[model samples]
Target: MTGTREALDTAPTLDSRRRNIVFVTIVLGMLMAALDQTIVATTLPTIVADLGSAGHMAWLVTAYMLTEAVATVLAGKFGDLFGRKLVFQLSAVIFIAGSVLAGFAQDMLTLIIARGIQGVGGGGLMVTAMALIADVIPLRQRGKYQGAMGAVFGVTTVLGPTLGGLFTDHASWRWCFYVNVPIAVVMIALAAKTIPTVRPASRPVVDYLGIALVALGVAGLILGLEWGGSEYAWGSPMIIGLFAGSVVLLAAFVLVETRVPEPMLPMGLFRNRVFTVCSILSFIVGFTMLGAMTYLPTYLQYVDGVSATESGLRTLPMVLGLLVTSIISGNIVSTTGRYKPFPIAGAAVMALGLYLMSTMGRDTGIWLESLYMLIFGLGIGLSMQVLTIVVQNTVPYAQLGTATSGVTFFRTVGSAFGTAVFGTLYTGKLDPALAAALAGTGIPPEVAQSPAALRALPDEVSAPIVEAYTAAIDSVFRWVVPVALVGFVVAWFLREIPLRDSTRARATELGEGFSMPDSADRVDQLEHAIAQVLRREQRKKTGPPGPSVRVLTGGTVPETLVWAIGAVHLRTRVRGGATLTGIAEDHMVPVGVLEPVYREASQAGFVAIEGDSLRLTDSGAQQAAVFRRVWRVWLDGKLEDWTFDDPADRALLDPALDKIAGDLLDEQSSRPAFAPLTR
Candidate 1:
């Protein structure tokens, strides 16, 4: 229930070599998760033909999607509890297992069940990968990495069908599922070796009720959408009942969150105007973007007379636009720390692009359609990629995991709804239009549903169906224009906050090295005083009879003792930079001991490592200042009841204290008067 950053002295950081390995595994895992969403589309026909289950084809995706959505919310909380490395590893194992099951499926039911299981693991991998980056990378440098991740999404989304088609056309469609197995094996191997076991200082309490309510609510809503008009009439009692139950459940979820000690989705975060606006914008961007994307291929395939693979290629302009803009915007935000303008402009462009799409017809040229798509992609790129950053920046460090997951979860929900709503609109418009188009022709209405049949029909007969299809797609996009416009309006209200600086202060407040003279005598006295105070604090614990929970520091006070402990880990002689061996040589310490210490400093929040240079953290520096003051007062015989009436006293005392502290620490010690390490 408590919210706190890690205390100083135990500052934690992974070495760069390890950090890079973690990043690669995360990227590949995420790519695998992302690729599955689209890859199945190309293989659906082959799957249906092989399994003899046209009725079950859509569930192949729907089951995966429904389960994935639920898992994403839980993954964030689990990562915070179980540790990202373990959660990530488990997710991979499950995903690989699901993939294996899917590849070996004997029936449509088994494949659908396997995909749903895979979705559960995929969801964990996706969110944990994101949260893990926040765990390992310094915030200021994360933009490029986040940008690259976005580019991967854009690329995979466009390329998924092509990859799937290659597997289906040449090998068995089972390869699509089998491919993830090898990639996942590699991810798991690298993960176990490289990903840090970042266990939390305390175990978290799970809100089972809150999780259940949200899951049930979302499941009901999604199921309603999935079944309405497609599986059942919109007004059918079953669809109506699902929608009604979802509303009641969601309302109960909101009410419960307000009462919970640790809510899965904290209602209080909505108070932050930035999070509110960004979340709204995030939802709209997902809604319009995903819906538009789903239908564009339909336009290309039917109206423009292209193959599925060719349809994907034609959508490349839009994907590339999104890719280019995401990278550019990410770099620009990193350099300037300004981001509000991009989302605003991007939303506006997206609206215009959606509007432009509405104007296309059966005769529209492929190049011109691509031009319109490029504009849409530009808009999506500018806004969607940056939403995660803006939300992360607005929340407290304690809430980072929740806030990050929240935005993503909302976007996912939006994507699901977008597909349903747009699908309904497209179907409603197309059915009537096609029926009328084929009225006098010898062609059955079923012919209009089949691309091959429609393509082989006489020109007089096919032209009207194409026109009807183009019109239906135009109508679907026309509805999306307003959603994009709403986002544009929301973007104006998004206030930009300065991104947090890249420092270990947020990591730990413990000071790095002792700056005072190596005066064993003075340090001895100061250490005695600190130990006495700490002993008093530890004796004052009021909790239950169990393992005594020692208080290391005050809520606001940085623990000077822990800083001293962290400083003891430092080997001598690097002012700014040195090779590892050089550092080890200077202090006559083995390189192995120093490596772990450096990692401890990095993670403890005591020190930050920039390339070869290690620097003290803000709190670490503060602790050091306190050390100087402690020594200055003691040397002046003002230790018992000291007070500095004038601010000028610090300047007078600091120089004297440093000189005295330095002389004592370096020359005299076989061991310090007080060995924090031994303690």
Candidate 2:
């Protein structure tokens, strides 16, 4: 194995207590970052009242998501370079700074800029948090922990709007951002105390030009769409120039990706029909979900005459519907391995739900509105839950990291584009509709912009303003119906390939439902494949390949004694030093029981005792290396079914395999602890 792949397995191990603490700390950091994504939804109206640019409402979401999507890519690269602990802490600080700036903003543009800053930090938190998991958690326990972490995203979706409303209603809208400050401060403090500093084993090439051009290109398109009808005429030079410039930059981005050593997004993955169709469907899902989430609160507030808290409460039906179907669909996919039907059904139902919502008017009852929102949420859940799984199942192992991040990247970009388009549609329609309704009544347009202010007006006066708001919201939902239908058509083109056992095992994880920003390295992906192999063997009650080990090691060392030496080596490498008591404690064995094994090894000159520390001698190191090689041979046999056609992919697999071989040896060294140990 090459040195680069050897470094892939370099991670710091902690005692169970410290590991759990660090886990909780990073999880808190992730929760705060994710909550910011949707917390502003219910507060958009009140934010407009203070900052006073109603047309810029979508930018609050667009800026955060756009920068966040860019940040996840860069952060993943940086985490591999600077160390996740440093990146995580820096992210917290940046998030706090952005939160402070946003809390004290004087205008809409300032708040939007601050949100962009927050996005950078939040993106770092999200990506690094996932990376940190592989660094600290034991591979045996990683899947369960990852599934729990995935549930956090689902919880945030349900909580963000309601929490934003509570803060907006009782204290102030600024509290939504302000709340992150103290929670983040506590998280930073806890993280510093618990997380170990583990640097990368090798350097990774970052595609700086590719990342920059794509970011700029996407931003340009969003800008053109946002400003087209609202800030500039659709045919004016400003909007037209923005649109023309974006296309050129995107073209350049594709060109750059082709030449770069390691592109942020490999242009080659699009050649696969599965990846292409999934990317489009992922985009539509994000477009519809975020767009509706942003404006639905606005509709409930202005048209339905509800408080911020009430609006947030009313949006729960959709969130709940999404949560239910997400979990259900993920479970079903795991059991049946048939997934193509979900995206098709989900997109069709989404269109139906949007059409139902567009039909809502002043007289629309709360029950009917709830039902519409529920249908929309269910469709989103079904469509989105499987996109990542399908991509992972079909993409080459070498392209696993890029392909996974690419799916999320498109989803986030779609969210920004959707919000921009939704905003343009809303403001363009509302300006004219409101003017027509208020012209004869002599009411200033500004008075009707604030939901609370409009609610105080006489029934006849408020009725027209309400109708105008309803019409604008109706137009926004109606316009997206075709987009959802397009997703329905695209879903048909997604080819159903046989699911790998590794991918199927992953499907059982509930986190697949919530669709958070996922970035996994090649080593991590290899480990995932190995994990499934081990799980299957466990179920079959497979025995160890003891005779194979004996043959490979020339019968010079007993397998258990080899394991003893390897355990000491692993502990010394990971924990700085090893002691008899520490090793015994880890394995739930008494010092008396472990004393003779080390004593026998020491007598054989495999280990040397210096005071309380145990160190592997030259002979012991040689024996452990032999054992590792034997284990590698066994792992190769167990995983022989996974054959890569490309030599480059095979090359990537070798190093990751080398790393996993060493890890498997270390983990197996502890296996004797589960049974009665016989020296």
Top TM-score: which candidate number?
2
Error of 1 at 115 (Å): 3.8
* Model 2: worst 10 consecutive residues (lDDT sum): 1-10
lDDT tens readout by residue for model 2, 48-141: 8777889999999999999999999888888877888899999999999999999999999999999999999999999889878877776666
For residue 71, what is the lDDT in candidate 1?
75
lDDT of model number 2? 0.84
Model 1 lDDT, residue 110, Cα: 95
Report RMSD (Å) for each prediction in the order shown.
Answer: 14.1, 3.5
Candidate with best lDDT = 2
Each candidate's clash count = 22, 0
TM-score of each: 0.69, 0.92
